[model samples]
Target: MINLYEVQETNKMIEESNLDVRTITMGISLLDCCDTDVDKVCENIYNKITTQAKNLVSTGCEIENEFGIPIVNKRISVTPISLVGGSCCKTTDDYVKIAKALDRAALEVGVNFLGGYSALVSKGMTDSDRLLIESIPKALASTERVCSSVNVGSTKTGIDMDAVKLLGEKILETAELTKDADSLGCAKLVVFCNAPDDNPFMAGAFHGVTEGDAVINVGVSGPGVVKRALEKVRGEDFGTLCETIKKTAFKVTRVGQLVAQEASKRLNVPFGIIDLSLAPTPAVGDSVAEILEEIGLESVGAPGTTAALALLNDQVKKGGVMASSYVGGLSGAFIPVSEDQGMIDAVEANALTLEKLEAMTCVCSVGLDMIAIPGDTKATTISGIIADEMAIGMINQKTTAVRLIPVIGKDVGEMVEFGGLLGYAPVMPVNRFGCDAFVNRGGRIPAPIHSFKN
Candidate 1:
């Protein structure tokens, strides 16, 4: 284990490759903060979060300087607001008050984003869940750092088409509400099927009810490092390619483990899982698609792309599991269109389509992420797409999500700039064919047969 060569290689990865910790998310439970008075609920959670996460950003900076590794974002994840506002919160406006409080707390703590402006309606929508979903547009438009998610489907429970239909309308409204900012509000909204409890990455991270009071989750990133490793083994056999990726993921995850342990100890919080996801950014060479291209594909969306992604996703998991005892969340390859330079290029070149991306999500970690669509796209059609992706996750028993941003007043072939990290993307067109009838008939699609194995 004491090898100078391995240590030197790790250093090179940090120096040369765009290797870094994507986020150090502190999950804080807001259950105990719940109160019948909406204002009291807001005050309680805000005070709790501000007091608990006061040192989060500063600590992350200290760690980055000490270890000489970059920590891109420091975030907070609280309990799903639906649970906290269950009997206490009355109307959509009441929930919006809570959202503003979350935004204040995030700014106070100096964190980039604060997740858990969320509801879990996989089985059915409760009164609070309905109120929260209805208020998404206003809540998101009014806040700066708050992120929201709605779980409309899960493996144990069939897809909630009612929630899907409603969320489709909400998403379109959110875009319209933030049209001046390229519909940025929709960018912070995610619809998930079987959404994880401990995911550190957002637009979808919520500290589930089962989670403890507080904890630390680290999401690791190193797609550039994997792509670089593949360069040395160019034209190699499949075995060699897989092995190379495995070793690269191992090294990347090992660093995440170190960072997670340090953050947990410094904060006096329990160490949560290390999410070894190959999360790419807008930066060049730091792309999951580039790693696919290096695997002999001319372009990322070319034929056989799905097979290539399947291999890469599997190998990353294999290499990561051994490096960290607790590897959870969506610990696989991410293919966000706007966030990955290669993916954005492919979309612009007309090489990638909405249909192809949906097909690819079957094997990748997330579904239809950061794909900007024409503003005129019908709400029913968006719901239909969510229904399809939800079915995929429900049937396969995998965590799948949809974060389609329909830029208001924009059409296909137009570009919408969401600025840093979120990057920008050309609005891709969707099939206008009528899925109106299917999505309009709202009810739960029964859980798959395998889910009946009790």
Candidate 2:
């Protein structure tokens, strides 16, 4: 089945197309580690995580070397700390302690990041959920390599306006606390609607209660590969364009499937899924926006951009599904502004706005990711942005998320650099309109009529 040309083609994809395994994530369950005593729970967590992920880093490296493929990161995701510490953590300080423990474990395992400091409060917040929401500011500010997320809406539960409003204030507080770092803490936190449990990507990944004790998930990305394939069909009809993308996606996802199987067997853990998302990077040629342009769009955010994105997203899924039976997570094209170089350029050109980006999310994986806004923007306005996004996901019954970074002391056109994968972005201006009254009158927005499936 494997031929010399196939081998050569794959090598070219890695060597030039910037194709690589974005992450090999080990998801460990911390449900059994929960204890009524906060410190005791921390000890259990640190022990369990370190023990389970001890070989994760080395295994990832071994695979990369053997296959001659580049694996960018080896990471870990665990049961939500909110659930693990909810019963015992009485204050924000208590939650910060757990974050520190998680950070320590990540350092020991040699993984760059650890996720699942999260709470799910789509309909209502429990006492513990409220505690975790309040603690996010201090918890993220104090820890390194620990990523957090909160689910504030879902198709079945509707939007939790109470949590959304609180999160706006908490996001501002987090920025203030980490102002010296260019409000870098907000980059590690994500707010979501219909957040996926099996996502291998960070800032949103949490080992859900539905998962097994341990598993391995692989996220594959290849914007450059897709772009290169499209070049062969330049000026092609829409029919030709769709086929080119789908065939290219099939090849990209096959690599991910091989990596996932190898990791699961080596770790003696069950294999989870392959997430074939076209996640772009800050690197010049490795951009999803470039792929859109290759498909005939002058620039992303121009009219027809959404239709171009929709075609790409749908084809990626069609091709990927046939390659792997167990495909899950946010398996579509990602449009994170800061992380993608083309998006940054689009924003700089004034071709893209927050409102237009919101429309794109209707077809992309996540919404408002790594987007930097002016520090002077009001919390109420942030809440309004989130409410609109949540409404989109809730109605469509799809997974969507928001990760807006409000840069402290930075106004529009000012740049904030978080470097590395978090990249840098110019602070965009938020509309100076008031949404205080709507955000302040907090209550749950009832689930859509379609949610009554059972």
Candidate 3:
């Protein structure tokens, strides 16, 4: 049972801070949907999604209304289609059809985004995986709500240099294909290291083979709630702030666990993980950067911000782990530049830079998310950013990702509005220094030593 003081503090956090549940993701495995015939496979894919996820949005809305807590996104993650399409597709066109099927299913189900239009090429790419990656640009340009991701590196498998190189080319292709659409296609793609299959977040979620046939995963968010809690102890020392955040996170994640368990029971699906990430939206109060500012930083990129973020991430995880049996995904604070108003302000004020944002990614949840760079930024630079983040995740053995958008024809300080949940981002500068040699090396960075144990 929760204590009265704790409940009061939690409510106070929600009242004062920007607090709301970010996403309630349902993971539906599609391994059983695989078939030798392309049409049958597509049919199975559609049937499985529509059948298993029919109640997802309605249930999420019901829970939101019952608890008075907003659930920002109700999403579905399925088995990586590359694996499912492996036996069926000999050419890239087959992959395109699969992408279309996914889009149709998502539209029918009224989901905001459907993930697992992805492939895990960390170790190596199968023929279908390569074909799927090759067709991403066309697939993304043709589809509406289908998000894509590629795991090019992991702690155990090391980095797949060939896949990384191909991904760089794919990024360039994706950028060019959707250049006219405000570069919206790139917004749907993510490159990850140590990516999790149970992740309910967009642009980088999939159903891992280890998961059950169907499950319910919850991603609870409350940056505003955390900020409000910190504001209550405005003049308090750092120790008190950390304590406050941990206590608040405990309550938030507890709600998430309860909601997830109930949803799973109601849906007759297994209970999946709770991703305790402070995923912010473009709303007024739901900003992760605001949480940092409440901790006394003048702005998000100010000095000592990283340390503060480190503490917040750690405490959120600590509190969340204690609250639930299974805690997974990028379970920390998300600082997507365009999605958070405070982050956008920080970027416009020159308080944040690409380099500084990269630095912050080292301590927080995801890396280089929703960042819009000049359209002319070289593919090598994009790859360089990816390599740098992958190196960080590789070294730390933690999950980190890059979801950057090269806004075509947009220069520094310019804004590209994606509208809706994607929001808008100011065009940020990228490293002018040519990393041609480093990225051109075009060889796999071997797995870390830590991965070799046993």
Top candidate when judged by lDDT against the true structure: 1
Taking every candidate in turn, the Cα RMSD to the unseen true structure, in Å, is 0.8, 0.7, 1.7
Candidate 2 residues 92-113, lDDT tens each? 8899899999999999999999
Error of 1 at 438 (Å): 0.4
Off by over 4 Å in 3: 1-16
Taking the tens digit of each residue's C-alpha lDDT, what string does model 1 give over 1-454?
6388977887899889999999999999999998889889989988999999999999999999998889999999999999999877788999999999999999999998999999999989988899999999999999999999999999999999999999999999999999999999999999999999999999899998888999999999999999999999999999999999999899999999999999999999999899999999999889998999999888888999999999999999999999999999899999999999999999999889989998999998989999999998899989999999999999999999999999988999999999989999999999989899899887899988899877
In terms of lDDT, model 3 sits at 0.87
TM-score of each: 0.99, 0.99, 0.96
| Residue range with the least summed lDDT across 10 consecutive positions in model 1 | 1-10
TM-score for model 3? 0.96
Sort every candidate by lDDT, greatest first.
1, 2, 3
What C-alpha lDDT does candidate 2 achieve relative to the native structure? 0.92
- The better-scoring model by TM-score among 1 and 3 is 1
lDDT of 3 by residue, 318-407 (tens): 888888999988899998999999999999999989889889888988898999988898888788889889888888888989998987
